[model samples]
Target: MVENLTEEILEMLGNESRRRILNLLSKKPCYVSEISYSLKMAPKVVLDHLDKLEKLGIVSSYEEGRRRYYSINRNLRVEISITPHRFIASTVSETPELEIDEFIKNMENLLKTPAGSLREIYKALQEFEEVERQFSEILGAVSLKFNEMFERFLTEIEKEVEDELERLVLLGITKGADTPFKISEEYGISYMGVIKALKSLENRNIVEKLENEDVWRIKC
Candidate 1:
């Protein structure tokens, strides 16, 4: 039985920079300077990108004198996942409890059968003991994608808020004891701007009101 290799490989490959490097290497082998020139990036930047791809075993390199040449390792097999930046290894094995070997072999053989048997094929898959493992893997993949998406979204939101706050301070609205609405009014800002800033502060848990409870303040 083949063990699942896709999940681990895909997780590592999901980095945009790394994926770009991999795609470049797949076409043909190139040295670092050649890659940097092709990608229109600095050699150090290319090295960082290659470091990640190499760690995932997607790319390999060998020294040619003082320089190294890298190439895509074609032997690596990946099972692409439906979700973005995710994949499962083609050689996934079922849990020990499942009678998987023969069942998988049968499915592979029957895959070419007529479309009329699709329902029966799905039913058979459901009945297979290894189906549990497949579902678990799917869930794991979903969770990973969600985490990555959430992280990127959070970073973008943080950057936007920081820029907004700088703008607000320039307009003299970073004063103490002013409610967000009051600050917005004083700075001639729209209510939406105030709301967004307040929300950002709340997310960072940095918003604090004075002892009077009516005065809005943010911790430095």
Candidate 2:
């Protein structure tokens, strides 16, 4: 498993386009057209990279109408370690014991089998109900864990930025100021000072300026 994970990570990093896609997604969730425009790549090419990233669980997407917005999978962390003997790459995240996709495929195949008696069908239904209950419990646990991890992550980020001005600037952006000008006016800071703080935030990947727009947005 370690070998397989290492190979997967290597393959992901080997492509320049994939790396660029990750960089952009890290800053903000974006639709395919947005990513393609920002990277100056073809839409088809951007989608190909997104597909590979999604398969590896490094990226995830959600649909809004006809557009799908892609973002990094914050639940999983990838780590690489090198020792004298070998290099290892691994993912640290919660994984279900029963693979849902495999379960669904098996159920579909089972449907082709000969019909069983009513008693057998009843027993199967009971078993399926038990499995469903267990899955629900597992999903609840995963959701709680993810929320805890996210809160802890936010706490760490808060501690990392100790500057009062920067924090205020971040708060302003979080409050929905799209540009530094609004933040500056609200905080009574000079425009240049706001820009400086914004630049720092951008460097830390805490905020991103949308392409073709003068507005900035908080990444979190």
Candidate 3:
């Protein structure tokens, strides 16, 4: 099994040249000189990008005498998780262990089944559709839980801080608007209002101000 290379893929694909190289390889495999001439980029740059792709297992290479060919396996799936509080990029496995043989068997009846049995065929189609509906329901339930957790976190913060400004400021921190200016801009509160709230929380040891930067965080 290949190791997880999500991070490497993200980093490697960030380069314009690497993206171009992958675009070229998607059409067909090529050697070093072939890529250089096709992309009009230097041979060294092509080699460097290919080297990184090889290490990440995103590109495979094989030698034909002195010439080496590079090709992309296209064995990748990207999954992005987005919520109000966080965003995550993950690489899902290229291959899934889905046991759909039973579903296929059920569909196989349509082969010999007469076209006059349209209603029967429709019923069989509904069975496959139910699978999609079940998956959608599960995903919807999981997404609701993310919001629920955030609301629960806010409930605890509300218990800790009675002032509305302080509560908003703390919530803003968790949302990554740690600086006073950012919090003010994000929540549409006045800049001075954010500063006053920060000072109040700081004096009460509810928040701490970091030196060198105008950043603040909820006191642990």
Candidate 4:
């Protein structure tokens, strides 16, 4: 829905004649005869088109001195998206104070939305920031809890594993060195030393060597 014929109606701009007539009215309010003449459309056709547009409530008419003038009524925006798996159409009425938060905001900040001169990106970022700021204490508590738990878990693992080399190899794998060669490079251990440590871990059921892959992972 458009509140202003002067403002852009976007995806709702239906046909060529309506577009031309609207394009004319956007510059200034126009009577029906002036619109028909300017657009080179017949007066009856113009009347029919205006009637439909008026019913949509985006165009409104007022009378003055034997002439009725028409202008855009309101501001509205519509968006449509199409893909092989999805089709979505959405409308947004003018909202000077709309707000948003949650997971969608974070994902949009990471991927979907790009910043430009548009107010949408800027407003979205501000809303996201405000949400994060409000939850800062909760976020800090979660981070600290994870750090404390991981440190305690590592300490227990260290007590269970006797050989220092086995411990180092386990730590390397846990940190993303899934292959023997990567473990050797990351821990600065000799390749044979890394292999020997891996064999000991496998025998103790502490880790497993993957079938058909030169990678390793914790047994569980």
Return the top candidate by TM-score. 3
Q: Ten residues in a row with the worst lDDT in model 4?
A: 1-10
Model 4: colliding residue pairs: 2-74, 3-73, 3-74, 3-75, 4-74, 5-72
C-alpha TM-scores of all predictions: 0.35, 0.38, 0.48, 0.43
Which structure is stronger by TM-score: 3 or 4? Answer: 3
Local error of candidate 4 at residue 65 (angstroms): 42
- Per-prediction CA RMSD (Å): 15.8, 19.7, 10.9, 18.6
Ranking by TM-score: 3, 4, 2, 1
Error of 2 at 124 (Å): 51
Query: Which 10-residue window in model 3 sums to the lowest lDDT?
Result: 105-114
Candidate 4 Cα outliers beyond 4 Å, as residue runs: 1-128, 135-140
- Clash pairs, candidate 2, are 178-216
Query: Could you give candidate 4's per-residue lDDT for residues 123-205 as a string of tens digits?
Result: 76786787657666675566567667768767977898989999899988876789999999978999999999999989999
- lDDT tens digits, residues 1-220, model 1? 1143565566766777667777888888889989888878899989987787777666789988787999986465444434442323453333433577677667656554345587876765655636557767987777687768856745654665566663362223333316766776667777687667666665666555567554555555
Tell me, by lDDT, which candidate is best. 3
Q: What is the lDDT of residue 61 in candidate 4?
A: 96
| Deviating ranges (above 4 Å) for candidate 2 | 83-85, 94-220
Question: 121-146 in candidate 3: lDDT tens per residue?
Answer: 78656765776578668876887798
Regions more than 4 Å wrong, model 3: 1-4, 100-220
Clashing residue pair totals per candidate (backbone < 3 A): 2, 1, 0, 6
Instruction: Write the residue-wise lDDT of candidate 2 on 1-220 in tens digits.
Output: 2667657877889999999999999999999999999999999999999999999878999998898999998565565544332244676565745687688668746543336888767777777777667866885576567666756655765897877788778767754666888989977888998999889988989889999987998776
Clashes counted in candidate 3 amount to 0
